[model samples]
Target: MASEEVVDLEHQNHNFHFENGPAAAIFSKATLPVTLKFKDVIYKIKIEKPGKFVKAAGKSEERTILKGISGVVSPGEILAMLGPSGSGKTTLLTALGGRLGGRLAGSVSYNGRPFSNAMKRNTGFVTQDDVLYPHLTVTETLVYTALLRLPRVLSKAEKTAHAEAVIAQLGLTRCRNSIIGGPLLRGISGGERKRVSIGQEMLINPSLLFLDEPTSGLDSTTAQRIVSTLWELANGARTVVMTIHQPSSRLFYMFHKVLLLSDGNPLYFGKGSAAVDYFSSVGFSPAVAMNPADLLLDLANGVSTGENGEDQAAVKQTLVAAYKTHLSEIVESELTDCSAEPPVAGDDRTLSRWSNTWVNQFSVLFRRGIKERKHESFAGIKVAQVLIVAIVAGLLWWQSSTSHLQDQVGLMFFYSAFWGFYPLFQAIFTFPQERLMLEKERASGMYRLSSYFMALTVGDLPMEMVLPTMFYTITYWMAGLKPTAGHFFWGLLGLLYGVLCAQGLGLAIGAAVMNLKSATVFASVIMLTFQLASGFFVQNVPIFIRWIKYISISQYTFKILVAAQYKVGETYPCGGGGGEVCLVEDFPAIKPVGLRGVSTAIGAMAVMIVGYRLIAYLALTRVGALKK
Candidate 1:
């Protein structure tokens, strides 16, 4: 945290040098000193006004999130934006970072130029919530990020070296082997996790860094450490900008510049030590000794009944008006005096979007997906779910003779029905859970959506299939549906095919709804309707609604299972094998379709598989999964 404690990726010889070609080119040079400048940055969005009556609910209004925000953050200085909730702290930060979308009226430039791919390559943005894979160790997390984010000019070993340097700098070596963890699972501490998040962005040695609330949800000591690290990083001649909420006194002084905001208005933009004096001159200074961050937040929130005893609304109005009248001119004047001039369009900026080839992207994402999903796919609870259901169903229909045709038919249908919905529920949570991580990576151009979705499709399949294989391995011989290996595999294929279709359906519903509760209910209704039309519940479905059978994955899967395990003319002696009644080919419970229709039924499910998954992918695009 002190000057002596700086981690020298360039000076102290960390085995990798910044002078080394494109692989090492990502390291901050401190020579291309970036000066981030924004003038009159304004943002707004439309929201519907809540109405007492349903008919009036469509009435809309424009809500302004930011109003005429202006600031400058030069290299060797760390700028902190201070505000209470709803003061447009994040909106302004996002605009400065070039990630905000909508009707934005402002200009942001790097060294007095618009954002280009070159700036994107050297920029790092850290979201407030740490979006990380929980099962991966800290070392693994950084290593993967380095691989995906670092330019391909670096060898695998070189990327590892970069990661090691960051790990050492962030003091994460102690917890390098620990998993990142989540709410249900426990691994590293929160501060350590926060450090890992910061470490991820620091890997590229970015010239410009934007972090949202780097100190939120942290203890004072931990918060201080994070700010101190950023301070050291900025002293490396990397312009660092972040949003902070109610920082401690010691932590508040670490900032080189403070931009205060209230009600979408910039209250002050100047040195941190000068904030109190500025506010005092503006007639809102605190009367008692207190943390500057607290006083700033209080003033920003117009906390009344304090030393001023002025009306809160009036205080807020006065701050906004005073800032516009005084500081706005100063902001523009400073911008005018800045040494950096606007860059001519397409003159000297280096252009870069993706660092790796698409093939390599797929490979890296596939490998990472495997490592991240192994636990969720085969966790004790999920395995137990499949095993318990298999055991129960097998025991109930355990090795019944062919005479009990109805019970055997029921067992086969159970295989179709269970797998149909089991995988559906499991797959529904996949897209929703990864939404945060996906958006974060995509916004950073870490990988393409196609590559990521392909990896997800391929990576999850092999592991997902294991559940059905385990279930059938236990229940197949136990239930005695078919004895031959050929029959066993055929039935297994049908079940797996049905699983894929159901999973596709789940993915579509999840992407479209995006809410777990709503997706679950919608899927429940749809699958139940399919089950009712599966021919086991009733053969005489109404003609008007009979169309459900054609689109019903369970119905087609049931047809395949029946064809695989039964012969068209086979008869089963009923009444305890006494031949009181025989289950003929025309039995109401089983369709008379033979193996000849297997191809047709499989073709139908194949269509559903592709159709549903295609719909799912498109729905993901609609849900803003792809970079926009």
Candidate 2:
């Protein structure tokens, strides 16, 4: 190790502790460092087979993902799993991290005991994909993470300072203000973004960290740098386990230990630098000088033939048999050596899924939601869309009097329809887009599902009203429906209520289906059905399917908007003279929606708003796999 770099890291660590004492102290080192051990860990799940391929269309088959894999990794060491694609490397990593839920056989333990909440609190799992908000700056990303993951003992200022320290520690000081942009949004490089993800886990300074393919898409230099960072972190009183897919020689040699898997079978579990020698001793050496990682992957794929003139299948069997005959006993001996655990100190509150209280979570998440969604809510295009629609509608029905009942009523219905479809489509993408990020954060036990859901719903509330309020103010008076405040505000409330209800349905559909394409299609179909049955297009339907209108949120919306403008006994000018004719029950837009049910319709829309959001919340709870 270079003295200069080590000195810089030490200085950074000292400065972090000095500047962020409260936040850093909350994540004090564990009493005993974690030692992960797994034995006979087998995982299988059922898959349905087609009738053409099996006896029945729905016949189930058990597919084994992990085949009794066993190994141990102690604290302050790097255990890297290496294999080709579909070799159960990720499966074993996930299982060892205690994040995989299934009919998992055998046992996985931390510090010689079963996986517990205490282990969970101290563990960090970084998935293969970098899940982050593209719009947030590097500083903002880590601050939010620290706020959520760090316990309540830390103040907001301390958390912020701690985030800055992490950024500096990760060498992200120059790019701290840069946004973590996505494919379309130009921002930091892939390597910096990967560090930000690691920084998120590093906020609480976990004792046990697991990363899946941290360097899957980097150049050899960047991959080496990333591995070196992990190596440094592991050496600092932490246990690091990660899955690597075909790493460079420099990157591969940094690992203290390596486990090679082939089709759910463990081919070898030993030192990384020793792997080439072990495979050579087993008669599968490369033809010339080769990267050890490459050779290990070749052996895992059974690409090399044996001295016995074996084919690929025979070669695979030989490797698996050889591991069981030689290295399996060695792994078992290591597991047996440190099987006893010392009791650790912690409480239920500390082990709880959420680090912060509900109020704290709601506050932080609500603020974050506002920060993340403000651009979407107030984007020029979105505002311009509403402004253009309002201006056009005002021009179309400009200064129309009660005499032109059809035009006035049509204008009112336009308000209902636009707000209905607008908010519906806008809110439908909310959950689908955030599904991956949401799952990542929730699985890490950052905050409760209720906190996130509530924050999202409320954070978007003020922005949700902006365009509608603007639209109503322009069209209500410009169209000459009513100059009175009572009528304008009542009609505005109805439209806004409808907007919220439609938004709820959008959220529900998005959460339930979770695929953007499929959710959009489903929402389109459901909304089209709601519009058709909204009593505007078809009022006289058969009795058999008449109940659909009762559930159509758009129908109640249309009714409320219509009732706010139209009165039962209102009179209109019949001619140029002072003669007048009263609007009857059969007036064009008045017939389907009566003026008498405005209050009841408002109540019904309120119920629908609550009901739809409730459904969305429940669907999300299931998706998050909420335990607490």
Candidate 3:
């Protein structure tokens, strides 16, 4: 029996291996060698300075971030960029990786040809901070990325196999099922998260990989492991360029070449092993125990107290001039040789911006959105808030009678305002929170903007509808407003539509600003404007300012709820006199003008929904495409 149990266990392991076998083969066979070369790359930014009291206020200055930097990174090489803060290592990497925005001087090429969008498709970039969905498990994260990024030519099984292979390759199999948690939740460690980031880029089987401080926040041991992984990747014939600060001696030795920068200027660009010798030739040498990376950085930044005892500025000048006079020729020679090589023959066409069709993208993104929304902390908070508000409102206006017409009308208006304001505020954080992830995926050509927008809209609808439904169900019976089935159903529909409109407006605000604080301030201003013009607060509007009433969704919702309760033919007791109260004649405030029927109010709400969502989609697309 024990032997049989062991056999069963071995069979399960065999099945797992078989499932991921093809993916390992694909990773080994699919990569193409790419050599990246940059020449005289200069990057500058325009900054506007607030002029002093007497000077012009809008004066602008051009700050150069990268000044004529040049280098070549061949296949099977790992180039480490060492520099102090603001030394242009990141700027240079961004430029070389095709992520830099604005105008850049000089040329960057891939495999002897001018850099094109095609090269970008074949390249990968790992940002310093890992931006991932906090609720997804490691395997789920990689599977989704594969589904969205892998070529359409591959089957679903093939893609799953590939994702699994990446999990194994990155040494993440042990924690594959663990959730990627954030500050609010418990999950994987920082090192594991960084590996996940690397695994995400590896999904494409990229030839060129750029990482911005992959080891920035890791412990020394973890940092060495990450660098070792890069070293292995480089040995596999991939070109890896990364910016690192103060690495250990073992990590420094793993790099094939090093580019030392100081104040946007290259002080040295050569082999990692020869950097110490070059510095020694320039009258600076470190002790045997000193980390070469630290020594180089200190020398580049003019902080090294060498044998020459030169001034800081003079030391910087000496290093920069030495590179220009001696090492620049070597770089130029390599660049010329790389540029002269012929292109590799094959189908080198660029991948499409989206791997999946629009429908598929929407479907996948919708599923992802639903998963994220279901696990979000705010979802529970929203339900709690809804229940609390519903109970409070119900108690405040308990079993309202027709004799108290003012309180009933005020209650209906309050319902409209509550639904409107709540949804608007909830949606303001949506786009801002996901902006970084969205931008990273979009820049990598993973999916279209429209697919994401539609998916988000559809996914949020079910959750969005649930809270309002709960709110209305609790408040409707408790307050005793128009208990008839027709009236209750129509009121529910109107309330739901009002919630959608408010949420759409919030999405637009979030997308437009892409900052939580700024979006909140802007949304608050708009919400206040709409609230004041909702017709409940200010029924008698001046003719010149009356247009505001037409644009206020709250006003439309209030009109619908009142019309649903007090139909044109129905009459109720007015005040305590027991006289007939006709809605059109008794209460001018609740009377419907053009928004008399349930259909008209529903139609207006639908229009607002489409208009605001369209604006939000456009704003998000614009922000996502804006490169810095």
Candidate 4:
């Protein structure tokens, strides 16, 4: 099956020439080529010892991931890093792409000069997993990326044209209008999704492209086509660097240069085809019909023996020494020549930052939020859950007369607590799931953190309004609460505010921990704490902890709902004596605090929303910077 797939891919490549596509036309409008060079680059990270309580303050052992690896990749060439698992190929690629964060020694230059944020703007990096919105159509995804990434010089129409060109170039015309769906929803194929990922980076026509396992999870033919497309891209005077696993000989020979690594050290770095000859000189020869990439991996893994009767380790040592003596000199000489040349001047530097205004970013993110939520949140299951819960609660309370004022209070408190818990739990997954994508874009300087936060807060309002409104509408009339429109509206407003506060708290928890499981656990603890202090379950005040109620959104929401249902002048039959009972005596929970008006409750909720969201934003900013 794999062989057949490979043949089919070759046939497709014959029929579909990437260089003849609209993307080629787009790339033909040239900018100066990029040359990326890294010299003696060493990247190390700290390793914390577990269960070592006696360790000194601010101290930990350090382990190097990449040790003094050096190489140069010039425009119009493809440099592929090949090695065994745990060999640091991806780390080296990331380091060259300027994405790795840690203690580092050595220099990486672009166009014969040190790298800057401006240079990264003109560079593209594609990760193994495609981080795209599954709900957005292919065209819509590309269009949005173009809007956010393209320069202001390009008009809306021009950006749209560019997006269309990229779609055509990637051969995604058939699925152009199809959603990029995932596990639950059916949408584009895996190969098509990979192409869409590539197309996003291509929208900006980057001068240098870096990919980590771009062909992973694809059949041989699909992988070949991807590499072939990348080759065409390189032919357009763009530098291409990627880390790849085992490749067929046909695919292996396609790369202009190949760097073989073993244990974070370079074993060989030279022309891809010349690798065979270089190894042959080091007393290592491939058997007849053996794939060069396979042989290289075997050598790097210390699983192969050489003709000189030495084991794999000795062979690797010889190869590394040979490359240092032969290939390293060539790379250094080339870097010197390239450095003598002057740098290219252009306005491309400014494009490194956001291409759109703050308002524009907020608008784009707002639209994205709506589209994502429409797919993930408004499904039949979610609506059914809300309706079922509302129905159950209403049935349990069952239209009690004012005589059963205790039951009414219980129902209102349940309403407040449930809304708070449900929304908070649901929102905990939001930031953790998007952390990788957000980190990537943020590192690229795509948009401000504040813009994204505000967009999320505003975009969620409509959907947030929906579930609670549906819930309250069914329960309010069914449970036989106050029937006046004024009562219903105020109660609904109070519940909506409760949902906002809960969601804000969830965002803060999610942002602070950067892990779904941790955030969920943390949010649960917070919700439970709020519930205990909400004034619903416990009325007696332990003076020392009574202040907890001031910070409980559930408490305020309950107060507002109770006040809305029972007016100041209203009276209810109580004490089972057919005597009228005053509102204050009937519900003593809010009496001490005076059961304030709806506005006061709302003001408190507003404060919670702002405070929690501010914490969320700050947490996200700090975590994003701290993440490697």
Candidate 5:
């Protein structure tokens, strides 16, 4: 028991106060004021998935994932943190990256200042998954990103030259023009893609760079090469910090400083070569285990099959003893002394550049939306659907039916309504597929929500107008629905209006729901409600149900279509003189007339469009693309 107490004391060396003058002096110099500083920073985390319900469930039972995680990487030093799986390494990396929120107690200072949102802009984070535009070639992708992101920052020649230089430095020139093939053949190799991601971050030349698992999943040789490449990249006056798993012996020498973590504890953090020796000095004998890496790993985990409590206790004791011995020597040497004064308060408060911030943000978003829509195809399925509609309308036009004018009006409403929803269905599945990329861009400040919204509205014009025009042109002529220029113009306007409204509603629903199934269900319900409320096949249902018609944009759209197709008394009811029969010659004309009903219909559609857009923007800014 006495020996066990000694072992506990040895392990508790890291838990010390600055009561001693020498100790205070050593600690004062330990964390120098720099762009990035973490002073004896301890990050304790409760292990649980992120969300409201799960967070609540594990609120009391949460286990600490990261504990006493403290380190510093100044402006010119690259800190390579090494840790075993489940050591909360990723959590620590993410905390520094500003991706997670928690009851954080540690101080993460930037520029010798406490952390702030502006620091986020100055830091570039590269996750395991490299986010790139798969459709664009390497050069095209980088150039496009540069054009949008660095528009006012550089001139045309300078931008191109900068992108080329970045590409050349990253060894991507050989494959610069090659397509970045992906899951569906959007071309590039995994290594190339990874470098591209790095290049993307470098384009901004952020003051600090943070990467998670930069060498993961590659073969030993490939991993070594990648690590060497990164070492070369970090040669300048730039700070690069990355979390790596079990690195090969060859790659170990590439790191300038190493942070070794085990079971939420910092086992060793300093120069790489002294790692094994430091452990040995603590009472751990390397003779028992030839591999220093394996020994350090086992010592960190604190649990091994061949080792009992005493055996593990000795290892822990050795680590503590070595740390204390090192700390004592550093303090006794009196390398440096701090002034006898309180430290100044850091500038951690974030400052927002309110003026014209939206303008730049919107421009970036608009460009991204335009580029995304440009690469997408609208020829195949849309053309086929339009052809099918034309054929069916032609067949219906030839059939012997009563009230030609009424039939024409019904056909016009059906065609307009169908055309309006095609864009919605197409985007329903597509938006979810690109959700991850959307989040990546959004988080990186690539664009603003309003800008993307406007760009999407404008960029979709080609397909939006073409598809509806084809449907209306075919149906109007084939179904004999008054082929005058006036009729065609109003009919087309009503159809496009419905289509745009549907597009807005679909985007809103898609953005709101995390799961594809839930989004589809919501869209289906909305579509059904609107279609039913539309006064198409049946006019008067019941008062309560009929009231829904006033709110339905589709109903008003159909009203416009009806007025455009048939003049008053041009076609009577099948019963000839019912209450529904037209008695007023000055009927509502889809074409201006007195501009009252037309204005009302247009106004209703405008309100619907804006309302759905507002809902979509709120969903995007608040919910984002994160799953529960």
Candidate 6:
């Protein structure tokens, strides 16, 4: 599907024209030729992998991951990324892929265009993990993606046809219907899934592709086959850029170009065969017949302080010089006396991306959420927990009567308090897992965070309703309160409020804490403290803890209960005998007196929901916090 130009990079005016078939096909109604350029780029990471403090003592010690990295891969060229273990290879790939989370520094341009939304549209990235939906068949996965991304330009049938073509091109026919397996199943070989990952990018037919350790976790032979397939992919006019650790001789031979990254630095970036020769000329020759990849890697890692170190340093100096030379040439060529014409302003519709059809984006998202819940076993657990709560509430009901108003109020408070914390806790439990998936999808522009939040709320509605229904149904009927349906419904509202508030609160907690262990601790302490301060069944809150009543979600929900159910006409504290029209008139406005007494309860819930979501968004955008 054709996308609205997001960015139009004007490097330098070139009157180059392609009349031949391939060129004609690419530039169907072409006007000008633009070149993508990459200038001096560098990335670094702080060494905070734990125990480093003791190792470095009071002295400030730092470690570099990828240093002074720079490269430029134009359209129709494959830049093979190579490095060894701990050589900052993955770091470089991730930075280039725009997933470093924070620890990345570089300007990546396309056709001399900066890496903005428009440029990203023309680029496809294949991470090591085949992150396709596991349940969907290979064709189904790509077809769904195509339908979503290419709907404006392709009909359903056309989408399917496009997916099929990509499938054939990537040699996925043999296992097109098979599942892309994970830790549990072995549906296809590692190589096939890798191909599928690549094929996903092929669907976009992007002008540029970046891959991260694509061949890792696979057999040497399988890795080689995958690289060979990738070579074929690049042959079709895509600029395939991938980071690979140690390739076989044959695999190395297939590379059109290679970029060597070591210790967060670019050691080399040029032709594949020439890389070996380059290292050899600088006195870092391969051991007679050792793999060139291994030799370059050793040369990159062999830096030290003495004579041998000096030799390694000398070799590195040569490689660095070559990197600087290539980087300077590319930049110099792209930006020289560049006076480009004004760009054409065409389609610009960000909100039009919204899916408003019957098979709307929300509908699809809701379905995905439901599927996710079912897969995660949330539905069954919700039912089970509701049933258990119902049984327990029934027992509590069987023990009391409506005459015990104070005790009943206490019971309601306890239930409301429990409900409030339940959602928060569930969020802590479930949101973390979803956070990982969310990051991946968000990076790929799957949908907006609002869409995700909406889907989650909608998808979990049934399950969320179940628990509140169980709680309210059992408690309302057994307490033997007013028999009116209005009363019953209000009772339900009070219960559901607890649940919603909890959901928001839980999400907030998840966002604030980066790791599960820390999140768990934070959730535990906060929930416990809130429950205590909620005045669940306790009459007196410590003077010091009085403020919690204002902040506790349970306090507001319980107050809402009082405001919704209490009969002001019946009684109050008017300084008379038992029933001398004891009244302070109608109940105080739903303020400091009743459900509104929650003071900041609603605000707290809002803060939790919005604050956590913002934090999660920021965290997801971060590139290197994963290590932490």
Residue pairs that clash (backbone atoms under 3 angstroms), model 1: none
Instruction: Please list the Cα RMSD from the true structure of every candidate, rounded to 1 decimal place.
Output: 5.3, 5.7, 6.9, 7.4, 11.7, 7.6
- Model 1 reaches what TM-score against the true structure? 0.93
For residues 46-136, what per-residue lDDT tens digits would candidate 4 score against the true structure? 8766555665666679898888888888889999999998999999888888877778789998877666655665778888888888889
- The residue-by-residue lDDT of candidate 3 on 112-221, one tens digit each, is 77655556656889998899999999998998898887756566787788788899988999999999999888989999999999999888777789999999989999
| Candidate 1 lDDT, 432-494, residue by residue in tens | 999999889998878878788888988988987999999988998898767899889988888
Clashing pairs in 4: none
Report backbone clashes per prediction.
0, 0, 0, 0, 11, 16
Off by over 4 Å in 1: 1-31, 51-58, 304-308, 341-352, 574-584, 592-596
For model 3, give the 10-residue run with minimal summed lDDT: 9-18
RMSD of 3: 6.9
Worst 10 residues of 4 by lDDT: 9-18
Candidate 1: count of backbone clashes, pairs at least 3 residues apart or interchain: 0
The reply for model 5, stretches above 4 Å from the true place, is 1-35, 40-63, 148-153, 280-364, 377-410, 427-435, 572-598, 624-628
Local distance difference test values of all predictions, in order: 0.82, 0.82, 0.80, 0.80, 0.62, 0.61
Q: How many times do residue backbones clash in model 6?
A: 16
TM-score, cand. 3: 0.92
TM-score of each: 0.93, 0.92, 0.92, 0.92, 0.78, 0.72
Task: List model 5 lDDT by residue over 535-594, tens digit each.
Answer: 555554677677776667667777667666555545344444563543222332222122
